[model samples]
Target: MSHFDIFIGEVTGTALLILLGGGVVAGVVLKRSKAHNAGWVAISLGWGFAVMVGAYLSSGVSGAHLNPAVTLGLAIEGGTKWSDVPLYIGSQMLGAMIGALLVWVVYMGQFKAHLTDPEILAAQPEKEGLVDQKAAPAAGPVLGVFSTGPEVRNALQNALTEIVATFVLVISILTQGLNNEGDGLGPLGVLITAFLVVGIGLSLGGPTGYAINPARDLGPRIVHALLPLPNKGGSDWGYAWIPVVAPLIGGALAGGYYNWVFA
Candidate 1:
């Protein structure tokens, strides 16, 4: 595919990915929404369907490596060119931000309702100058809808969780040939990968919300910080690097493992 196609495909597919995935979280978390408190199972299934739809939509064009980690793994595995890595990642990030913005737009009323609720606002800590970021809790009222935070605030544990979860994800993609060359996922591959994401969420999502995709996490987090919401709390900038860097590490490792062991 041409560079222009790659850019368009990644941007559009990834936007849809974050739109549906983040939308699920908003539905479950926000008050006045019908799906509020629908819980983790809904979230897991929603994300899986999000990936399936996004991949299927863009597979023919950009191979639907919507996650930077997936793109990195494909490049390391020789399916994608290293020279194109920046474009792929850049487009994914842009798409993710756009998707996140769309989520906020979709849930604007819910966000206003949730944030302005006196009871909800009362539960949030004062956001004057929270110096100890690492020791901070994982979520604010609506922060969970935008980005992930750990149930436990240990850096090492959080990083390891993201790395391992992402490792399982990328390795599966590599082994299954989900993003092979310009093929991305066939119908079967899309289904398998989508279900695999749900499986990972069910099994390993408790600790750190299973941020296996860098763009999925970081792009929305950036949007969270920028969007004008009342009592939105801090963006947890200190914990943000793990979701971005660890997944890249996981993807690189998965690619190396495939080259050495699975190949």
Candidate 2:
């Protein structure tokens, strides 16, 4: 495939993917939204549907590798040329960032409300009848909108969880073929991937929110840091490396494993 086609296809596909994916998170997390408090199942389904729609639209052109992990895994598996891998990742990152930005625009009022809501803001340690000015800030609501965090702050466990989930995701992508198209996953494969993402979210997301794709987490996270939102706390940069590095490692591992087992 031509570089231009690949870039545009990936960009469009991933933009749609994250737009809907992040949109669901924003919808449920933000207080002013109708979907508020819809909980995890809705989010999982929404993201799964996001994958389905995005893959269906882009599979013909760029194989719907909306994730950097997927691109790397495919490269390692020889499904994608190594030379095009960078373009795929760059486009996916750009797309994810753009999608996150759009989510902000669509939910601008909700974001502002969620961040500035008196109920949430007053729950901070400083407002909890504590006179200490050094009280810790509350980052949960806003952070949930942008990226993931570990439930227990255990790095080793978090990394292992992401590694295992992404290993399954990337490996499945490597082997799941529906249409026999070169490198491109067919319609059935897209549907299966959507359900697979949901399954991963339900089964493996509890520990670390199942950030199987680096671009999916990091791109929006970068946007969260850059955006001008009220009371938006730290992007939690300390824990950010886990999602990115672990997924890449997992993808590489999956690729190597698949090559060893099936190649």
What's the C-alpha lDDT at position 237 in model 2? Answer: 79
Lowest-scoring 10 consecutive residues by lDDT in candidate 1?
126-135
What is candidate 2's TM-score against the reference?
A: 0.93
Off by over 4 Å in 2: 126-140, 178-182
lDDT of 2 by residue, 12-115 (tens): 99889989999999899888999999999999999999999889988988889999888888888888888888999999999889988999999999988888
Q: What is the TM-score of each candidate against the true structure?
A: 0.94, 0.93
Candidate 2: clashing pairs of residues: none
Candidate 1 residue-wise lDDT, 155-247, digit = tens? 899888998999999999888765445677778888899999999999999999998999999999999999999878778888899999989
Give lDDT per model, in order.
Answer: 0.89, 0.86
* Candidate 1 TM-score to native: 0.94
